[model samples]
Target: MKRFPNQIIRLIIPFVIIIAGLLIAKKFLVPASFGKLGHFRADALGEAMSKPIHYVGQQACADCHDEIVKKKAASYHKGVACEVCHGPGSAHVDSPTENKPPAPRDRGFCPVCHSYNPSRPTGFPQIVTVTHNPGKACISCHNAHDPVPPHAPEQCGACHGDIARTKMASPHVDVPCTVCHETPTEHRMNPRMYVPTIPANREFCGKCHAKDAQSAKEIPRIDMGTHGERYVCWECHYPHLPQVYNGAAK
Candidate 1:
């Protein structure tokens, strides 16, 4: 090979020296454990495994609070785990006297799962806080362990006696109050002058009675496409007494 020119040799020497210096530094500077687990430190897994567990689970809590567990079993909250609202119980279990788990009395506690989030399943009971119970604590109206009310029908009748009586006399007596009136959870907690708005649109009535092939045949169904779109369902047939003659003679 022909010898490099003096200018080229000067430029090449520094690059070769710099690469060699980097390799030497890498050999000494990098930790021995690094790259043992695909660029992670091998000892990190051991350190994490050595740390103590924080959550003791619902079973561990049931061992000490059998009475509360029994009460919960009979209530609507039976499916909810104790530790979900109570927090991790391991610290409390280890030192029961000193590390008592705090009571979940805050108004915000129940709404964590109960608040009306659109992503939540449609069947889950949820409420809009401002409309449901503006300033009241949940525990004030709802029992902590057994949140569901006992006499719902009677409670509803107390305020809406006229509507309740009309509903009872109507053909749709078997239909539940909640079928038309969404539970006014806020109104129950704190009395309000206005109740939740009742829908009078054709689509609202169509939910149960639309003449879709999929709808239950035992119940009345109407074809909105052919049926006069100008008139609402209640205009001709009173919702509470749909079977009774209330409209003008045809």
Candidate 2:
């Protein structure tokens, strides 16, 4: 019995000593630096990890960021709250220590409400068609802080350099790129802006080719008629402007 008690004491003494050492080390270690030892304070960690907290319910966010709430009001998304598209964010805000906020996946977040049907203009390219990756999120290019699409097609050229260069070489280069490409709220150009109300018709081509239009008026110009559905004004008119418009019918 005496030997058994000594053996137990030896075992417990090591454990007690280890615990005391931990306590002493904790006293010396700063709370902020405790992460170095793999110890994180829930409150501090929560604040540190707070990265705009995906969809933390617009209401809760509005409570703090009323300015954003006011700006977003009366916008297309006003009917929808932060959680409608972002999913549940309360758990993340409340217990972010254990729960990690969902990744900012655009396709996944949008499809929850938007559909491919024509009724939903936002889904035109369809989440799947535009972004092959379902995990892709819309906010990647869009800033929720300033929900309005502030970037124009010129800005889009940053990521779409090839398209931008190609467009620069096209006859339509004179037109501001945004005239054709629009944002979430306005995607398609209004057809009426074209003279013929048809983008491919001769009248549509006359809008900018004022000189050609005047010459054609006096010369009874050739009725290209969209080149028998084979080519449009772009095919004949060099997009590089005066340097490219050689005055040749072809």
Candidate 3:
């Protein structure tokens, strides 16, 4: 550059001034301990330590609640810490007799962890709290300390809960579960080993739906010969909801 052009010099001047201003401001504005060891202020460690510790950890709970703690450890809730639901235990630790940690007993409280959400990790137990055993507290059936079935499932809904909920609102609500799936008594003890039988052919459904079938007159009738020939009824219609199993029909 033989000589600095006025237009170029004007742009350079503002940038230089701004850079100098930022450098000068940083020295005064930033904490003295900032970036001492890393990006964090060195004084931040002391600030956090000054705050009071609330949780005494799980071992602290075993002193008084040994039986319940052992039960929870052996159950599905082994990984869950006690304070996660019960809140901070510092108050109770100082006066164990007087300050009993309040327990969550309401139906709404359990849903915070157990309610159905797609974002939650797969295989995690979830329920549609609105339709799942409505009007009953979760603790009524499930012991909070050791949550497992009290006995073998007496109702199909105990395991096939989603299907049960659908059938509740469907036209087949009055239909018995045994009518569709021929479940054996042994299936209750070992469901995997002793499986239930599904309808093999359309004739099974025709027992209820055929026009001339000896069944309730109020039940909808279909011509088994013409309607859904060759394919089984369940291929198109879900027995529980009594609608198209796949893509929407209505």
Candidate 4:
């Protein structure tokens, strides 16, 4: 019995000392930049993090940003979550001025989740390449929550009135404007949507005008040589007047 008491006392003393040491260490220990367990602590901490400021959910935005929200609702991104595009905004909401979070103000921050490339929410493969700056972030040229498609005409003639007039009356009017001037992509304006191998686009026109083509036996073959290889057939055949033989008429 006497020996048992001594053993119990010894074990309890060490346990008490260990608990005391832990208490002291806990009191003095400063939080790490990423907290005590680093990445391990992130998940638990993330749950407790500050909410967002701007897109206080789609409903909140819909209340104030009615026009923008309406436009976005009609876009391909209607299914995407507001936070998915805007990022967490609790800090900004809690102390909007004191924290002055970047989400509300900058494009770079928006890229974190709403990447310029096809991110999680923007799941469409074609939509991924629809960025002015794919290397940067989604927010660079776009407001992720309220994305807008490019309005600029894909054709060179859009700005060049003379070319526009000539092409409008050219025989090649059947062709799409984007077929020549605009870069090839699944989606317009998105660089990532570009096809790695777009076979000879000019050859498309050759398919129709075999009689006027270089290989044709009828009209003395016009040897454009290097120029023909590089330039589209539409460059010579006015789009507005595709029937008019700009080259040696067959």
Worst 10 residues of 2 by lDDT: 189-198
Candidate 1 worst ten-residue window by lDDT: 186-195
Off by more than 4 A, model 3: 118-122, 151-250
Return the candidate ranking by TM-score, descending: 3, 1, 2, 4
lDDT of 1: 0.79
What is the per-residue lDDT of model 4 for residues 10-48, given as tens digits with 9 covering 90 to 100? Answer: 999999999999988867773444455654555566665
State in Å the error of residue 86, model 2: 5.7
For all candidates in order, the CA lDDT equals 0.79, 0.54, 0.86, 0.55
Give residue 119's error in model 1 in angstroms. Answer: 2.5
TM-score of 1: 0.45
Q: What TM-score fits each model?
A: 0.45, 0.30, 0.56, 0.28
Please give, for residues 1-250, the per-residue lDDT of candidate 3 as tens digits. 4999989999999999999999999989999999999999999999999999999888999998999899999886787889987889988988998998988888988899899999997546688998989999999989888887467669888777899999999888999889888999867755775899988888998998998999988877889889989788888778888864445333
List the candidate 2 regions with Cα displacement exceeding 4 Å.
1-61, 74-76, 86-107, 119-126, 129-135, 144-250
Native-to-model Cα distance after best TM-score fit, residue 130 in candidate 1, in Å: 1.2
- Quick one: best TM-score, which candidate? 3
Q: Which digits, one per residue and each the tens of the lDDT, describe model 1 over residues 1-250?
A: 9988999999999999999999998899877788987978888888999999988777788878999988998877888888788888899999898998888998888889889899996446678987986899999889878888644433667766777799898778888877877767755533453366676588888877788746567776668777768988788777776674547322
lDDT of 2 at 30: 49
Model 1 off-target regions past 4 Å? 1-48, 150-250
Give per-residue lDDT, candidate 4, residue 4. Answer: 67
